[model samples]
Target: MNTLIKQFTLFVVLTLFTGMAAVAQQSDYQIQQDFRTEYNELLERIDQATTTEALEEIEEAINDLEDEYEQHADLIDASSNPDSFDGAISTLRQTHASAVESISTIEDLNDQIEDLETEMEGVKSRLDQLSDERTTLQQQIDASTENEARQASLIRQYRENIEERNLFVSNFLGELLSKYQSMDSAQQQEISEAAGRLEENPIDVIKNVINEYINMMDQSSALMAPDYVSMKAQHGYFVEVWDSIGEQLVNTFAPENPAQTQEEVDQLLTAWQSSITNNLWGSIRTSFSENGVELAEFNSSEEFFNALNSYLDGSIETSVERNSEEDYDVYREFNNFWSNTVKAEWGEMFIEGDILSQSQISAIDMKLDDWRDEAMPTSNLTFILLIVSIAVIIGLIVLLLTRKSGESKA
Candidate 1:
């Protein structure tokens, strides 16, 4: 029994030594079996590391139980006090707590570093966005600059057009001023007033005003057409009367002077208008009164009437005055009586001779002198105004469209 007790005590000593080896190897199960034997040694060594560096190193060693703890976070939690290394583990808790307090002071600084890195990523993203914005802005600016160039070109064209139109204004205004000087001063003032309420183009307005005057004069010139018509009617009356008289006289007096060719007679008749208007005032008055009316008065000589009457009786004496509008009063009286009388005489001659068939003579058309000269016309100003107004409206719309596009980009 004594030998057995000695053997058992030896076995216990060996087991204790083996447990010490396991403790060095960080074996929790082995350390548990013989903790009583190794506990004092662990405590002595733990106190030996008293300096801060030595404590810190020991704390590193203990806290660097990182690998072990990682494998057993739940097993080694503060509430996970293992019965095997309870006292040693308890001693380590105090040291680790002190280290934790020191590390807590650096936590805010470390978090700040992480936040700064995150903010840098955000800043990079914003920088990228800014770069894109800058590129888009550059494109917009380039387009706007091109538009400015186009607008500048338009301005240059406008200035050039202004210069060109000034020439028209120069002539129109000069003529108008000269005309105005001759007119009543009140008339001139009225014209100036008429020019005031205008904007588009003053030169064009002046030109349009002059064109209106010219057109008005052209329209009024139609009234002179009556003189031509009356003269023409008298021409017809003289032609029918003289042709009949000449054919009868020639046939009776000179039967062998066979009817002249159509061409020769046409030539002879062509000269009649100039002939009689120049002469034959008395005969014309007699013929006109016989038809229906009378001449107003005789400003012309009897020689004039004789020459014309002699021509109607088949004599051609070309010596005659060129009666101008200076002779208007004399001609006007003759024309006033002849206007009705000659037309009536020509109608009677047509009825008696039946030179032209009724259908042909009756179909003869009479047109107003306005066809030859208009009374009032559709004005050119209206068309020009329409074109200019459309251009201005289109230009304004394009400008507005470009502005809206630019504003949206901004």
Candidate 2:
């Protein structure tokens, strides 16, 4: 009994000591593997902040860390007990693989983002250039439109100046020509030779000729009383009156008197030509004197056009005189008839046989009526013939039908 008790107590003591040792152990198959798994997970998290500053850094880290984790995972096995250590290691390895693969995918996405940003910057530059070009083209279009309007205005002014200067030259020279022509043939030949020698500086010639006329006017005025009209005085008087009537015309086109630009002079001349042709000289001059230049009131634009047409027609008439006299006579008779008819019609329509305020449209209506009258004779004849032809056709059809019906009945 004493030996069995001692053996049982020894066995119990050994078992308790073994249990305590097992509980105190830092590394046993299951415990060592749990510590390793926890330590590896902490290491993976710490290493996740890659020190290398590139997308490729994560790729390298994934390969290196995944290999290390798998090797560590192999240390725990299916043969191990308690903690099912092999399963834990397998789960940890799979997590490591997933993390590594996720990092690689993220790195690829980041690289693609960088390439797209770079391409976007290039596109932005081209868009900026297109915007700049569009602005430049719009500015050029505006500048061109302004330049064209300015050029048109300048051209119009230039034309008017030329006309005025030419008119002044023509009148002054015409006076001299008339005087020279009155002389004997031998003296006239001498005058012509002298004129041919004068150089054609239009401005110089204009100044010289106008000054001469001015001097001639001064001498004549000095010789005569204000009310007295001598032969020389009469000529000067008419020139003075004409000059008085020309003030508005002169002022309308008068550039700075001390020095006129070439373009201005040219345009003044053009205005003068139109003014002279339209017989608006006195009216234009009076308006200019009153400091009121309403060119629209003159409405001489039509008169100017009509004068040009008349001059052209006169030349054509001369040519027509050489052709068949019969045709010429026919044309003449037609012209006379048309003119008389128009004058008679216009007088009756607008005047109310005397005086009436006619509208612009009413005037046009009057002209249209006259034009219609011209065509009425021919139209009336055609209308009559058409009615007769239609009636004859209808009569023939009726006769034929009646005759056929009568024969059929017989």
Candidate 3:
């Protein structure tokens, strides 16, 4: 009876051990299934993630799963059938990494775009200030009397403001161009939409810049004492800006008609040149008349130069007859008008502004030199007359002395 009790106890013990083993095996299988289910869910989340925050959350979950299943990894892999647990883990890690990279790129692009928008706002503000200041300075110039020093000072400030504004524009454009070239089509479209929200489209900004430059040119043309040096410098800067950014702007906004845009710009520049030329000619004509040099109506610069040459010829002929101090004063006045007013002011401006050629200026200078040589008072004739009179007086004294001596001797 004791032997029978020992066998039953052994059977019961064996049964308990068997049951525990089965339960533990089932538990491991359950853990493996749970791991796969959670990993697949995280993968789905990664696929659906749109933003950096979402991607980060997914990456954290993936790392957590890796840590939780680290010890059971071997078991999970052993139990896995068609799709290996190791493969799924690798896929989740790789997919999560890819999603994070993509999200980071997008976020970086957005940050850059925001920075550009902020910069654009500052640029706009600065440009507005410059415009206001220029207008005020122009008003001051117009309202003030004809004080050359004050006018020159105001004009210098105006030009400095213009240069500052243009430099800002150029720097902004360079940054924008770099960003634009780096972007893909979708990114470029996004930027374009952002620019629209700001109500300052890049193309429109370029157009406004061109318009402002033209308006400034018009104002210069209307000014009584136009700053030709400033105008030429500004024009050159405008050309450089246009060359750098013009094509890109057209490509971004009006890709279909680049040639038309170029043609329009050309026409505007030509018009500006014509307006300045006409105004300068009108001023020259008025100045000539004020100086008592009557010039007929001239159709072109060539015709005006011809009339000028004729006047110089007539003046040179008259210069030879100048003998008195009053005559010298007249010559000095004409010479001062030519040197100070015409050559120093207008002629230099004409050459610098490309209104006249160097050769033409050289010809005019030669004629002026000839006129000066002939008009300047000389002592040669007076000295000759004085020497002849002295010789005649000495001869008469000698004759009287000789006649007295002869009479005394008789």
Best by lDDT: 3
In model 1, state the lDDT of residue 184: 47
On residues 108-190, what C-alpha lDDT tens digit does candidate 1 reach at each position?
A: 43453455345434443543453344344434444555587664554444333323333433443444344333444443333
lDDT of 2 by residue, 15-38 (tens): 999988987653445545555666
- Residue 3 in model 1: shift from native, Å? 20
Q: Model 3, range 1-410, lDDT digits (tens) per residue?
A: 99999999999999999999999999998998898789879989998898989887887887788889888878887884455666777889899889888778767767866776677677777777888988898887776557888977886787677667767776766676665545555655444444444545565565566676668767752344234333543455556656665665555555567678767775665665565455556666777777776666764668777877887787778777764455456657766876787778666556655555678778878988887677666675567679999999999999999999999999
Candidate 3 lDDT score relative to the true structure: 0.70
Candidate 1 lowest-lDDT run of ten = 365-374
Candidates' lDDT values, in order?
Answer: 0.42, 0.42, 0.70
Better of 1 and 3 by lDDT: 3
What's model 1's TM-score?
A: 0.18
